[model samples]
Target: MPDNQNPNYEIKTIVEIFKQENLTIPEYQRPYKWTVKNTNQLIDDILLHQEKSKYRLGTMVVHNNNGELEIVDGQQRFITILLIAKVLSDSNFLDKDISYFLTHLKFSNTISHKNIARNYQAVISRASDIVNEKFAKFFSERCEMVQIILKSESEAFQFFDSQNARGKDLEPHDLLKAFHLREMNDSDSSEKIAVVSQWENIKSEDLAELFALYLYPIRQWSKRQSARYFSKSDIDIFKGINLKKSPAYPYAQILRMLESFTQHYKNSPDRLFDNQEVNFPFQLSQTMIDGRHFFDMVSYYQNSKNKLFNRLKENEQTNRIISTLDNQEYKYRTGDKYVRRLFDSAVFCYWDKFGLIEIEKAVKVIFLWAYQIRLTQQSVFIESIDNHARKDLMLFNKIYEATHPKEITQLLVNFKIESKAKNSESVINLAKEFQGIKNEK
Candidate 1:
């Protein structure tokens, strides 16, 4: 273990790595989640790389816990590699080291155990003709990686922090999911499954945009800050108290008490007659509930944001003024798109804090505030929209500060048409609509 004897890292073939002492999947590691399709993709990637002299699979971070090497990242691919080895070793197509790896390696999360079996079958089904002795040898030797051996577990996360900064493939949601999973050290398998299943069902890209477009901006603007981007550094705003592990501070205690009450209400037989549901009180800027509740909150907001915005055409459920805003007369203006998002975000902030009470009025107020910029400016930019949302209208702040919906709905928005603006006739008609809104009680 002396510095003079070993380099900080090493580049090795998958075959060579198998010959070394096995890497440990610490008990804290989350379940193996790579799907059968993912396993098939790995097989295809290996076959594609067979023609090359060597292909770098990617970097892996391993903590040197005294002498034991524990996997810190890349566990998805790590487990996939083991499943591949198990397949190759089964047919006697691979060498002794791979066979030894199969016999010696063990990781026992229940979800992982189930996935390992499913993916093992998937590898055989996908690779039967493709993974012959030549492909197996190529995968073992020509596929390569660099294993980073840091002295402590925190170093592993630090390494990922730097990697994300450099814009590597480490996804922010994935990193946060794994971090919160580690916090759920005492969670039973079913509880973990309940949380993981919902998350795995949503596409990662959708998750990213949900945070960026809706969740992240609302939190920052509610606090009266500019939130143009939601990067890895900004994720602490989303990560919240772990009830069991976080200190019993007053805020944590309130969240925990609410968590307990909500669970009890949902499970109680008295609530069954109405077939009703209870939603956790979610505010745009409240402290998150950490593990299971964190996952549930994300799922809730993700669904809520999609309600009227994602459709190509309107329905009864769709907010009609949204359709009005999109009417062809003025929708083609390039800046109108930014105005639409600004309007929706403000309304969503109010709706989150105060519910659908006078939401129709709230929408119109937000709409008049939003599109007023479009009517006056020859061209609108995102910075201008950011200004309007954060400070110009103080729209988000009003909602953030209000204890009741009346404070927002009862406000008057006054505006005038700029006749010189492009699309004068459409702008005049749109300006006229604000008159009716002002006349409403």
Candidate 2:
């Protein structure tokens, strides 16, 4: 591509190319990193100049290179204009007089005015593929794309990359984006995390917003920059706590934070800083955890559970199931196979970790097995079993896994129950007996 020292170009609205292929941001060219603040400023500039130029001058700086005007520094601004135009179009704000002026406002309109005007519709037709809808319609009624000459696509791409990277100070998420895009080929498991993968699918602007909401809290928590960096280990610790137990669901944490932020600035939508927006109420101090840490904790918990469930499901290794007793908590009823596996695992964890006395463990196990089988089997004779045995069994089952039948024999041997066959029946048979008991009572 020929590099023009002072590339002469004409301004075109982005809406003019609405149907054009999104120029695959060349691998060398970084993704769009402009902040909302920067975009808002560009809008200010465009509005100020457009008002001064009577919307006829169309104060856009387009460089002439090859097929289209290569918008090096103004792509985001052009995009914003298109968005504004869309809003205006949806509102039916554009008049016929304004449209007519936009149709003939291109460089070709002044160059090969007559010949270009003849094929103006065709050129605008192609140009509309890349142009924004609002600006394209605005220009179509006035000047046409046939009025503009060809420009080099490569030169435009190069200019856009060089100028944009130099102008903006990228945020943490921006750097993370660049890192991910550059090292997407990495083999690290952390890199393969679902949270990171999901981040890759969204726009850089959205990613930055998420990062800011979460990272800003870390900044507050730390005395050093290194401490401000949120890591997988920190998130892992938070997730462990979450799995242990909580009054609220994991998602509630982030939603709670957003609600807090929104409430803090409800009166002043324009303010960026919380202090500038309003006096932040210090109520419910417990809810004031850092947004990033809280979100990461929840994300890690959800992602880990997802990973474990998927892994187990794929391997058909769901040996220990602890299904919900009711539908309210998104629980499913437990099947017999699931119950047995879960009981075995719970005994393992409790016996190995908590070191319950052997006699106590046996007493607990037998009682639990009897009660569970009765509950599931609907046994009628459960009332005939000693009340103490029933109570101990229920308590033990709650504290550990009640699914494993092996625990029953272990309990019988430890308690040294002389009459093993006295109360002994298959859980299914006991269930039948329990049902009869229920009818009798």
Candidate 3:
């Protein structure tokens, strides 16, 4: 390959550069990701420049030796800049200092900074056969291909990375979003609308964070099971799918799922402060599991004439128990069969039979007790999840004892809190009382 040091390089305008063909990203490269906030910030930066006496022109480095011009860096800024240029395309601003500032800037990077730059320089130097002919049209006036004579592809890449590091960072989600958007560009407007719908209003940065957290599992699963790594591209696609599917959340098995969601929302309060975003404060309630009373309740519900407990137990077993790791644990758990049967025996009395939502809450309550039993084996006060689980356990037994005539009335002979039907309400019900929504509007 010829050396890339002696090619014509200059700065150009948004109208002068064309995206011609997209440079391929390597397997090791991170994804293109940006949140709404980041996108907004870029726009704001351009607007800020326009407000000043002179417009700020960002550097767009291009290697034009090949049939197709490759963009080694500045993809996000380039796009954002394009958006600004488009907005101001016909305005007087186009010929003003702002436009002049944007159009006449040159960007240069040498391979000395990094090995990749050397490779990039080489590719540019021998672009005649290095790049595909089909994408050559993209290097036209639209992108203002300010051809930079670099030594090699490595040189170009190092410049790209360094230049980008000095400005805004590219994220996996932004790239994914860009890819999807570009892929959909050729489709009908209606179809394109659907694609855009998938690109929610999350800031590009927040989107990246969310993608990192959620895609971790899928990434691991893919790598471990397939013995192949997943690209940010793969993760980006999977994230769209996950957003669509609304994957079931088993709070007990993976509290991280719940916690991650909360953490992101908390971190970006600007986005989440509104009632629509996160109205309900997430709480993990803890309840006490009176071993004897619980076992007895299980037995009574299993054999009760009313058959309330059996139905609840059955629901719990089929819905919750089998879904847990312990159920599959080779160490302790036996068969889910007996558990399901026993759970079935409790269904009639369990709150779930009354309503699905209520049942979900009830499962949490029961799980709190089970979690306590697990923790009791380890230590008191289950420190991992705050005191939520412990509190739930205490409340469950409290409510159970209060509701059960003989149990609470007799047990309370020596206890402090009185157990009575009126007093044995679920915490949720008590919360309603506290909210004072007694008489609905």
TM-score per prediction, in order, is 0.75, 0.24, 0.28
Candidate number achieving the greatest TM-score relative to the actual structure: 1
Which regions of candidate 3 fall more than 4 Å away from where they truly are? 1-55, 63-65, 79-318, 321-441
Summarize candidate 2's per-residue lDDT along 332-430 as a digit string, tens digits. Answer: 323333333333333332332233334233324433453354343423231222232224343333333434434443543122222222232343242
Whole-model Cα lDDT per candidate?
0.75, 0.35, 0.35
Q: Could you tell me how far off, in angstroms, the CA of residue 357 lies in candidate 2 after the best superposition?
A: 32
lDDT tens digits by residue: candidate 1, 1-441: 456634278898888777767577665565787899988888888887788999888777888877878787777897898788777877787784555556565655567788989998888886665568888878788888888878765566566556665675656777777667656657885676677777766778999878877888888888778877777778788787778777779867778778888889999998868788888887777887777778888889888877635531343323466666667855676687777778778877877887667776777677778777887788888787888777776888888888888888888878765654565454456456666633224
User: How far out, in Å, is residue 293 in model 2?
Assistant: 27
In candidate 3, what are the lDDT values of residues 1-441, reduced to their tens digit?
244455456666444443333332221222234344555554445434442433434555554435544454554455444434433433333322234433433222121123233323433343343133222222222234344545454456545544444454455444444333333323464544333433433344445533342223222322222212234435333322121123554533243344467557757858655644532122112111121212222223223323433344467543443244233231233222222222222222233123233554544434333333332232222132223222433332243223333321222111122222221223223323333436345
Question: What TM-score does candidate 3 get on C-alpha atoms?
Answer: 0.28
List candidate 1 segments past 4 Å from native: 1-13, 16-57, 62-71, 79-91, 97-144, 148-158, 267-276, 308-318, 328-333, 419-428, 436-441
- lDDT for position 342 in model 1: 80
TM-score of structure candidate 1: 0.75
Residue 9's lDDT in candidate 2: 51
